[model samples]
Target: MDIRPALESDLPELLALESQSFHSDRISRRSFRRWLRHHDRVFLLAVDQGQALGYALVTLRRGTRLARLYSLAVAPQSRGRGVAGALLKAVEQGARDAGALYLRLEVASDNQPAINLYRKLGYQQFGCYEDYYEDHGSALRMEKCIRPYAPGGDSRTLPWLAQTTAFTCGPAALMMAMAGLPGGYRPSPEDEIQLWREATTVFMTSGHGGCHPLGLALAAHRRGFASEAWINIEGPLFLEGVRDENKKRVMRIAHRQFVEQCAAARIPVRHADIDQGQLTERFQAGANILILISTYRLDNMKAPHWVVLSGFDESCLYVHDPDLGDTHPRQAADAQRSALDCQHLPIARDSFNAMSRFGSSRLRAVVIVEAGPGTAPTPAPAT
Candidate 1:
């Protein structure tokens, strides 16, 4: 099918397509006319043999980070071909040329095929709005950054730029570990009680490793949380003196020097100790905030790590895990008995406190800001 910019004459065909795709009673002709008059709206249509097959509608707003793709449709008969994809690509390129940082869209949650297609195109899932559409269906918000093209750089040869994808803490840690960061600090069950004592903030390292932690630390720093993570000698160190085991020993001897350096930069450092109970109590008292991190795993099992104890009941400790990947209050209870057990590692409320009390240096706390939904514009599809 030939793709072309939509003209006034295509309004009738566009309305007809919309009527066929949506409930005829819902999208009235009046609504279509109103849409046509909207300023800065980019509409496109695809046709073959004088028959309209698809269309896209986009809106370009000034002083925004991204262009919005508001609506896209492929005639029911033309669904399986690449009509929708081509329309999307064209709109993306157009947005990039117009100096947009990202292209954003919303898709119905039940439309798995569309979600998959968007994912394959480097779109990252960001958030969801409940009842965001006409039928009160949920909408999956997705975005793809349109990197400015450099004149001499070969797009084909360059590695894909790492887009700011979101993830929960646990899976994020695992990913970081797998990506060859310094992870795998599977603390001995016996080491748990000691670690909790020295820490003011518990940094749970889960998922891909330090990416979530780094991002969270940066965020916390912005929010006024004094954050620090002990660098294992064998792990990758993104920050100075934040390296593997050998460096840690040196850190212990030169503890004053390390503290001074961290103080000068407003970042604190202490060797890591894992504690389950004291950390939970601190969370309950509001002195400590847990940032649980995780990402989507293939099996759908809950990957919990680095949880903060926000509150507690008789059986469960209310905890916050950042692994939810969205800015919602992600709090869950840890069964008191189970939490006391040596599952992945050993942990106890008093044990962790005792360990911290005896450690040469205590755990460091960092400031972190929680991410939340902002007013993002609705995406329009290609005309």
Candidate 2:
């Protein structure tokens, strides 16, 4: 059997194979035809003696390095003939050639044979959805890094810990950064609250205060990590929302205290902007970054939020968002499973730079965490 791109003439067999492979969530003939003509979508088929055996469909988005394996189906007669695997391999190559660094897919949870095949082919489960299929079955989300390997530890291994509260994104993000290093701190609710208590600098309009860069940097340093902070503006931050002079005064005092504490602890505080190129370089050099972004791009809210810089590809940057808003609000039991979709979440390089700035003044803040004393920089993974 030979694998190749699907042509318009292959539509009838493609629809036939798709119907025989799955009982629900079948792709429409129109979608198949449209994707075949689309430049960013890859549709391929495996054929033997001009008989279609299997097919795979991959979708790519502009300005991102991610590809989604939208569908993969093999004819019933082609079972155990490695047709499914060959179709999948063809899709991966097609996706990579189109500039995708990763490929993601969702498979039914109860499909053990398909799951086994995916695992054997290097796809790992990252997240899942409950009652996802038309038949109310769960769907397991899986992904593979299709990009060529580079030096340094893969940041995708870092745990995805969502913020327990709306106002604790800063502390929650710092917790994830610390947890990514060798002998890193284990994150828990207790630590999350304590870090918030220790780092909060500005009292917001209603909710608990937002954290300052110095506050979070000092908190990480106290936990024995080497931390540095970069801020685009000088003086008190997160103050534009405050209407009460008393509250603003309090926030200013808190910011001053954090600045003094950071200085006494010998943490570097660079009062300048750190661009995306610099962030990518630091991340590749084995440091985890805690960056502040405007929630407008992420959730349509004009507010500040925090996330960890998990990884970077040629055209995209991946983040572990502490906010679970990417999906619907989830129960605690489902948070872990839902977090898979948010882990190593990709953002276009240009979009990330724009999202990193917050508020009308367009503030940018970052906390860079290096390995602690006596802990060498994380090494590259064993192939």
lDDT of 2: 0.82
lDDT of each: 0.44, 0.82
TM-score of each: 0.39, 0.67
Task: Write the residue-wise lDDT of candidate 2 on 15-62 in tens digits.
Answer: 999899989888889877777787768889999999999999887744
Return the number of clashes found in candidate 1: 70
Q: Candidate 1: lDDT of 287? A: 36
Using alpha carbons, what is the TM-score of model 1?
Answer: 0.39
Q: Whose TM-score is greatest here?
A: 2
Over 82-175, each residue of candidate 1 has an lDDT whose tens digit, in order, gives 9888888887877767655556777889889889989988888866768766778888978775664211111111111111222233222222
Q: Lowest-lDDT window of 10 residues in candidate 2?
A: 327-336
TM-score of 2: 0.67
Residue-level lDDT for 276 in candidate 2: 81
RMSD of each: 20.3, 6.8
